[model samples]
Target: MDLLPSAHVDAYPREHLPPRDQWPVLSCDLPSLAYPDRLNCGAELLAGGAPDAPCLRMPGGEVWSYDDLRAAADRIAHVLVDDLGVVPGNRVLLRGPTTPWLVACWFAVMKAGAVAVTVLAAHRAQELATICGIAAVGHALCDIRSVDDLAKAEVPGLRIATYGGEASDDLLRSAAAKPDRFEAVATSADDVALIAFTSGTTGRPKGCMHFHRDVLAIADTFSAHVLRPRADDVFAGSPPLGFTFGLGGLVVFPLRAGASTLLLEQAGPEQLARAVAAHRVSVLFTAPTAYRSMLQLPGGHDLSSLRRCVSAGENLPAATWRAWHEATGLRIINGIGATEMLHIFISAADDAIRPGTTGVAVPGYEARVVDPLTITELPDGEPGLLAVRGPTGCRYLADDRQRDYVRDGWNLTGDTYVREPDGYFRYVARADDMIISAGYNIAGPEVEEALLRHPDVREAAVIGVPDESRGQVVRAFVVLRDGLPQDGRTGTAEALRAFVKEEIAGYKCPREIRFLPGLPRTPTGKLQRFRLRDLE
Candidate 1:
């Protein structure tokens, strides 16, 4: 197994320590060789060497090796380029969860030298229409489940291909007769590989353009330093292929290490644990929330094969980390990754973790805490906005919001954090969305964490609202367990509110609480605080 050592200096053992000086600088200008440059890194690794190695495992229980993956991609590349007449740099839309077909289509689009426009697999017809309209996509390859939704959108010139089995029954027969082997298409480093949708909490999602170099940057840096993979390891995760976090976790990292990845149809906790045992998945990349629920499963599932479990999408709480570690011996790797930055900025190794902190910055990136309003750097242990600058910088798709997000080469994620003296970062909250009432600054996450501790509360969201008395008191919107009664005595919404008061502080106690069927979440399972605020 490849030992990807700690990027965290203080956390690193004396034997595994990286050079103190000249270490923070990134190794830019990645290898350039091949247009539609293959967007998914898994197949690109096959072209680089390791041809026959296993690469993808679908939920239906089929394994496709790297040679198989590349062959499949090339065959489709021929169809997409020759039969469909797709041009280099043209946008070819791709949608669905992590299935072998989704993985194949992603690379096939890139191998054809077209930009892979990825949309959330969970997106409905209206969402698909809006994205296709914005990107002017003329072609799409989606799963059978999402094909109906994509078809519902009356996108002119839009051609769609289904990926439940074959492109169609006729194509399946032809592919079976023909011997499968294909050469990769040459793509330029500067050529666009992917246009991923950013989770627009407030409004419409924006397409973030990333280059082939940007796609490989994570493999060279974070993957090399953090998730050092082995040939025997099998990768799997929940984030849909549309999100960069999922793309990197399920495809890029393992392929860079010449390993296999589990491309599941469903990655919910139960399915994920089952996939782990079935495929012998060793490395997991998912959210902290999912890990917490996995612990609640009857007795604990066999995760013994798992060597690493990465948590992202939101801050990984220490409490959640403790619960997961106690249930399964596997330590959860925590990090903070945004769509724009390409991959994780800060991450911790299983052995070198401080539960609450988001590890140290990756070798290629420089991170610091800054005043949200002033944009000035803050001292260690002081709470401020987290600012980062690195090789993989934020490049939006001609959006005016770029000016607000990127200033002086620093990409400002609207998140609050504190830099520990030892270089780890502790997440505070989202900068703008924090709740403040009666001269007290309260992070919504703090209260939500306290609420999730209640057994009856399945989910909770905290938001500040206009109040006549307290001037924007903390209000919590909660979702009770399905079996639990909605009645006041049984569901315990009021009791949970009181519990939060005791767990946190009297001032931070939710002034009002309401029970709902479920909390509104993004396709990635991130709580939509903007929508929650609207409910108030």
Candidate 2:
């Protein structure tokens, strides 16, 4: 209940932490939720575990044990401190596919007492620059294939190092010469551990600052109480590690439970099913869209190994849940979570799962439905904004938007929901411009800003339109700059889309672009996204 003093003196992350008053009130009432003031999550996750305990299993049949992971992380941490001159509380950016090495790099940053800034591998040069600049990242451990984009980000004085490459300059090679064992930094529970970015409606990324304790809290609460994963459970999912959903489901939860994760660098529906069958994955974490697609997979795919399936990212439709149960006789565990909160805070496991609703709050957390305008608690069955306060809550780093996310000790998750008398929360529509497609959160303004970068586009408005397969796809209504030939309409649209893909991540690019004479706007020029949705 009290703040813990950090051990690191540099504390660059502490300097940028939002003012104390703006922080969401964190509560840990459950006995299982207890955490120490002086803690290092990496040490807790990897140290003192059985040497032969399986920690990670790659799709290629390669497996790493708890001891192996710790040794690898220790080597990388030595490289960070001795070779890269990294100090405690420094922000280290990680950009790579979801591989065992990337997970090692993640723990390595925390082991060295540095804050991990995980960036999605799909991000382009511009998006990477914005994130690095906002976090003031000074060092990056990047995948060799991503070197070009990292260079294009153009952050001054940014020390670049390579990982997962066979080159002599790769982090793996440099780390091999280091000792096998190193002491994990003694970071306080309240010290910043990682900065995960979520897209803002205003076209900027908001870095959600999480503490070292918050990481373990989710594992103890959600993964422990809800999913109830055992040490032998093998976790696998489609979400990129950059997203908290994947970081928790694929890495933190498994590591905390002493379970192994079958890392799928590029897991689509087919790949997911195959991975599950091949690796005998016990727990599956993926979005509802993937669930539907996996159901459509041709016969003879043995998913019998899957005992528990968790769906999040986008709202889980009751139909998808029923379909999964019908196909596999295994109920899908549906939960809702945000990057700010780390992972699923409200989820039901096994028989507690109620179809069509995001189940009761996981132990150690509290949730309520509140009127969006007044922030007053709404009666059961009345849909309004969802507010939650628990061990893990929103803590935006040095951003004034912290005031918008956390108010009156509660984090206002920008989601419309209804709480039933039975305490099950049902999802409604999002209260913002965020579009959850497949499993990625794409902000409409961020995409519009990317489209605006094109020379031929004067104005652009991006909105999420319903799609059967992807949940929601980015659709753009563009106002082409005048004086264009009438026959160039098709070419211009395609060109604008390509230009946007070049500017931002490909997934954020508008899948379908329509030329509009003018966009619907108020007298003050405020965009009416409702009208755009109506056009769909």
Candidate 3:
């Protein structure tokens, strides 16, 4: 792959991108993915729609119109260049919840031709320092409430600016005095726009670099084709802006469609439900766990306004999908995506969705099940590694693991799946999450689905634990519905075990069941099975 003439003055992110030969095969076959050489995604997204139209909304009834958001972003971009001495391609770490101001900073970075490194507001000092160090971040734009931990990170020479505060030096306060009009940098379409770090479920977090065009590519392919957002639709979800899932669903998709989205700072299942009904959210994006949890709420929510529901971050169990449809009469669009790929590559909406299987590759992408070692395409119905290539694919920043993720021009997503005869891909388990117990190959998610079918089970996580006789045995951690009996631990465990045995093969049933208040999950609602394995 030949390099594009970079517009970056700093040149750090581009220099750190994986070697060209190590990059995954990137395809831009879709007509919509053809972007101009000098592109600024921040400016592109904001360029759509009438200036007076609503763009971002908050739970408190505060709405920022397209004009309002652009003015704020333009002023912030001026502050970054004039006051902070920032140049194009400087990595600016953004730490905050999902807020209009936080989003403004993201666009500000884009307009200034700087790279954005967005981390979860819940991250501690160590995690923050690791990310800053890995990306060689020099400046940070943080929310006042979450600035303390970032300050404690103690990255040397890391200049920090606080937003949403009363301080005179606050980002918003400084921006107020600056002119609300500035020219967006004419960056190359291939210019690095953001570095999204993985959730670190397996081990050390890897920074996945995405180009400016990649940001719009996801919206063009998945959101345009599958989600099919309308300008009148109000989008809302549980994921924060730090996660690509949220960034695409809440920010990129809606903006590309000239729609509005409600940004929630703390969106749990109950809160998400209330927000949806209160704000009349039509498009929803969240994980399967949240969908299942919302179903078990004591006083049911009025979700009649919902027109589309998307589930990702983890596999969607067939039982949960059926239950949601039965309760809401809406088919949940289930998909599988990776931080490396930036957003979903496989998904189907409306009548095209097949229960339990992740739909075919989105229009601009190609997917196949392949042998992990040899990279040979496997026959349909056989479980193998998932290989994908599309308008967006993995491009790790200065990491040796890039070779491990992209092999033979294909990105092996480290997920095990089976391609049905109809071409739909069914998730088996994560490559590392597969359990071999007593010579039987078992998938943890399969067991989890069977357990979720039980009436009392609110949430479940299955993992293989070491056992002297069987080499490894299935262990399940369950969270029961509220008001369920907690006194008879033995009786309840036995009954749940019996239920699972009835649902799945007796050999695949969990031999050990432990009840818990809740399962360990990332901020994005992905079950941290590695943490559960550590408990054993």
Candidate 4:
């Protein structure tokens, strides 16, 4: 097809449920599948491909080539197996943003035949301890700065792995110095590869166990139909590598497509824009909040290099899409994926996209709105709970909610959506996260997306709070941009509220805007609505 250099990265080398050929199908379902299920991952990169392509380009233009990445992975692989006493099926708790070291640690874990449980770098010790306890993580690969906090966490007998900057890591260097030749351990398709934790605005957290097949499944679904990538392209983004969103962006998607990845250690909308301008990153994966942030930045950031953008972790409203197109002539491909689904299960090409709708189901998955209680699919164009399923499935580790989630073969993501007559899926709200005030059923995200449309608002989080008078009232926690309007008395806050009322239904508008420095967020780019509720 003669695509761009960075766009040629591999996806699912082979599609399973749909049975694809061009895609590389990785399966641990064999005698040859390596233990720790290593071969099922970037170990293939060891077999020779894109050797000189940039794997990771950081602040100093310190880019690591695919060859360098593989060698580094090999060293870490040896350390994992020979030093840390890691074996097949053990989970390695990894916490960090996307960087060459993070990438190396990921492949090295898988290369050593171990499953990687990615903990959002933003997770506090309590969250970390909870994940380790749930996933049975015995070893941790953490950033040096955060190792002390992690050490204090309740991961009994937890082995520690530390790295120094990008190149100055003795721990990783010792591992990376090993012979660049090591065979991947045998593993299987159904074997868990990652325990991704996601929170419902209310609960503690649930660990979504994804199989090796699920790793390729997301690409099988989204690549051909949505944000397709090619070799020679460089994938980079603000979503932390710990989240599946970033895992797919900085590693899986690019590796699956035979492309390199650029990992940003410190990522925010501003930092991402500067990095994008400097690196000419081709495919960008982030949230709508970051997109809006980039638009407010001064013009001429040289974003001419961006070709494809994918938005998830939150609903992508119409205004954000327009703002992106106006800024870069690129439409942000909006996708809605749950940690349970591994990655974006519903998405569409920007050209084929419908602005507010999350888009149609991916190539290998089925999406339908259903009555949550009845467990039956709803008629077309009807709004109901969104239940989905695919060949690559989700199994919660030791959670009783498993029965509640997967009913009669359908993975009921706790979300409500309306399926358009034309097969598109529109975001409604999380079934349990919906806010009911008096007679109005308010979707927090709907109101939040509306608030983000305002120029002065940097980010907004909407949550319903208890109110005896009108039932539950919608409250918004807003972070103003660099140059917010002055006049606290009746100016900035009042203007934002007015703007929200104009953008959305008056009933759905936030009753009050509480200016804050920043909205609470998880590492993967999901705004923590739970925190918004706590602010009350």
The lDDT of each candidate is 0.73, 0.84, 0.93, 0.73
Per residue, candidate 2 scores C-alpha lDDT tens digits across 16-81 of: 888888888888898866777789998998853478998889877889999999999999999999
**Which consecutive 10 residues in model 4 have the weakest lDDT in total?**
7-16
- What lDDT tens digits, residue by residue, belong to model 1 across residues 448-490? 8888777677667788999887788988887776687654453
Off by over 4 Å in 4: 1-39, 45-48, 165-169, 199-201, 449-458, 479-482, 486-488, 491-504
lDDT of 1 at 37: 27
Which pairs clash inside model 1?
34-186, 34-187, 35-113, 35-186, 35-187, 36-110, 36-113, 36-114
Per-residue lDDT value at 297 in model 3: 86
True-vs-predicted CA distance for residue 467, candidate 4, Å: 2.1
**Top lDDT hit:** 3
Q: Tell me how candidate 2 scores on lDDT.
A: 0.84
N/CA/C clash count, model 1: 8
Better of 1 and 4 by lDDT: 1
Report the lDDT tens digits of candidate 3 across residue range 44-90: 99986679999999999999999999999999999999999999999
| Root-mean-square deviation (CA) per prediction | 8.3, 10.7, 1.0, 7.3
Give the TM-score of each candidate: 0.87, 0.82, 0.99, 0.87
Candidate 3 Cα deviation (angstroms), residue 366: 0.4
3 or 4: which has the higher lDDT?
A: 3
Identify the runs in model 2 with alpha carbons over 4 angstroms from their true place: 200-202, 433-536
Runs of candidate 3 exceeding 4 Å displacement: none
- Model 2 scores worst on lDDT over the 10 consecutive residues at 519-528
